[model samples]
Target: MTTVQPTVVSAEAVDVATRGGAGTARRRPRGSRPFRSPQAQELWGWTFVAVPMLLFLTFVIIPVVMAVVLSFTDYAVIGDPEWVGVENYRRILDDPIFWLALRNTVIYTVMFVPLGVLVALGTALLLNRSSRVVNLFRTLFYIPVVASTVATATIWYWLLNPQSGLFNIVLGWFGIDGPAWLYDSKWAMTAIVLMSVWSGFGTNMLIYLGGLQGIPRELYEAVRIDGANAWQSLRHITLPGLSRTTFLISTLLIIGAFQVFDQAYLLTKGGPGNSTLTVVYYIYNQGFGGLKMGYASALSFVLFLIIAVFSILNFRLTSRRQS
Candidate 1:
């Protein structure tokens, strides 16, 4: 039988077809570009972020800058601004109402933040065990979180009414006279603070529950093996594990407490001689009610500074504690 042997191609012929016989050299299409370098890739990455950066500048940075500028002026809504320098700030510092508002804000924050954290932690501990009903209970607790603050405030206002109110009726059983909650200067802010704690605790509770669940069971087992009781396990293992979540929740609650307005507004209107007047409430009255826009801007920026300082301090403390 006759067999055909395959022809061996010459190197020169292969080079003509493949650009080079070494099989390394190849020409790309004319219009195509090569891969980017690391620096180029990073430039492109930041290019993609340009739109978001611009949006943030427009929405947040510009508005803040404008407010700062306005704060240095005496601008009302109807007229042009006259530059007043530190006059508005001086007025704020000298204002007794401002002092009262600050005091009330501090009191409200002190009352609400710890109470909210403790309540959330306690509730989360109680609900940490796995069960089908736990999810249902979680949803029930979360209802207030999703509900409107105005609606909740309105409901609480009625419930806290001194005469013919459910809260007083409950207090009546103990033969205690329930003071006018929203009407009395003594009880108005306290009532609002309590309601705020109740309304907000659910959200923090869910967060703590998540944190608790994330801890490995083996750690608890090891603790038990070491003869650690439940309290010891919680203190050494659970709490330390939950540090990040606690820090985050506490920071948020503190900020929220400082910015308290809705409950005070809807329930008390900072009434009974401005006793329950919070910083934000005062800002609202100054800007909108009194039409001192420039002065209000100053007040707002002061509040912003206060919140920023506290938030930074909390973060630093939390980081130190964690480390």
Candidate 2:
């Protein structure tokens, strides 16, 4: 204790030592700073985005650019692409098969979109009440959406079989002869539309459910207090509340309808005189089957324009209604 002479610490030593103990001075390098600098932040941000941006450029942008360039040429998956100006696009106008496919696609959209919206809304309305059984039904209905499209097409193929099928057998109970569904051109597209609606409506139903939940319970309570019936509440409150959701679902339905391929391809093969030949299927036939890549690209662009126009129209109509 005596040896621990009253040592006076120098200001320099005190400055270098931590409060708890003496240690080596830990000064940052001259002009160096923490990572909070704007330059550092921007560096990290770019590092995060670089991979995704690269991928998008590689897969999406490059392919789209290539398709545009190829659309103006004659590429048949063989030899060099020959420059053909707008010959492919001009050919589209004179192609009766193209017009037929476009007509079928429009018909399918008209039937599928409205029916899909109604079914989704109706299911969502029915299941809005919270209950375990209702949750179970929701899960069951969504199963079809997750199921393989090929499997769904296969199931419907048998279901619509003319001689020995569930649909015809059920109709016979009412003393009604069901038409040959996939075999007859008249009913083939209708049969495909029904299958499509059944397979896809579950997704839109979930979307409607989300929209329903977002509507304030207070609104429903207020309507009920004023003696509003269920239908009246639905008409005044529910429908209006779900208008945006309806528009979104309808737009998606319209796009998918225009791109209809799987069911028509699997069940009908555009058969019975190309009754169910959708635009996408025709595009496929030209691209791969017929090996006319350039024409397929032109058709694809045309379809894209159609989908864009319809989606824009849908948005405008929805906005007008909301206003």
Candidate 3:
């Protein structure tokens, strides 16, 4: 065999061959860089959210737990809480005022939700047309939404005045006698419903406007090509399009209707003989006015359950329509 020549490796060849090799990687400087791991990232996340979590635990979780515990006892804020079993609940069953309040709230919700949805939808439809004037009117409608609830209630108090309010004056022009709204038990709840609708419809109008805008123009065009009338298009396209929005608005209105207090408190003080006393007003009276915190907590849970039931029912009903 011929003698094998020993290969001469040049400096450039050695440098190119050794570049990014394991030995060079080992020799590279780390420069004070810390190694990161999933556990470290997770720890950092928890650290960042620690304060907010603590506050949530302290304020929301703790209070809800305490309310549940307190509902089974009589803690009138004057002495040690004594266990009362379901006696408070039984009292609620027998309490005429509770039933009356529930009825009034139910009636208010029944009257308010449909009217609110219709008025909001109508106004939104009217405002949805492309024009500067429509935009201006949209802003005007939403102005009441930003106004303070207390201030709006005060304004309604003046507006609902039987003798001198603009409402009766308008009725007077029609040659009809307007009844005493706040002073009459029969009209007190109705008056609250009207005021509630007026002050709050602006928010629902915006929601409806958003829903209306989301409807694809193709659907309307298709319906139009099919020779569908305005009512048919509304029934098949517009209403169906706004079904979910209606559900959301209805749920909110129901919850709010059951919890109505500020307007009733300011307008009639739950009077005309307790016609406007809602469940929330009842809870307020017990919790603060009468110092019956435990009973109030029980009432609160009951009201919560009622709202929950209604909200669930509304969701189911609206889901069917949407489907």
Where does candidate 3 clash, by residue pair?
none
Clashes of each: 0, 0, 0
lDDT of 3 by residue, 97-211 (tens): 9999999899899999989988898899999898889988998998888878799888888987899998899999999899899999999999889888888999999999999
Which lDDT tens digits does candidate 1 get at residues 1-323?
12332233345445456664334324444543445478887988999999999999999999989999999999999989999999999999999999999999999998988899898999999899989899898888777877688989878978997998899999999999999888888888889988897788888999999999899999999999999999999899998899999899989988999999998888888887787899999999999999999999999989988999988988898888887
Ranking by TM-score: 2, 3, 1
Worst 10 residues of 2 by lDDT: 20-29
Cα-based lDDT at residue 243, candidate 2 = 91
Candidate 1 lowest-lDDT run of ten: 1-10
Candidate 3 regions exceeding 4 Å error are 1-36
Model 1 TM-score is 0.83
Against the reference, the lDDT scores of all candidates come to 0.88, 0.90, 0.89
- Compute the lDDT of residue 119 as modeled in candidate 3: 88
TM-scores vs. true structure, each candidate: 0.83, 0.88, 0.88
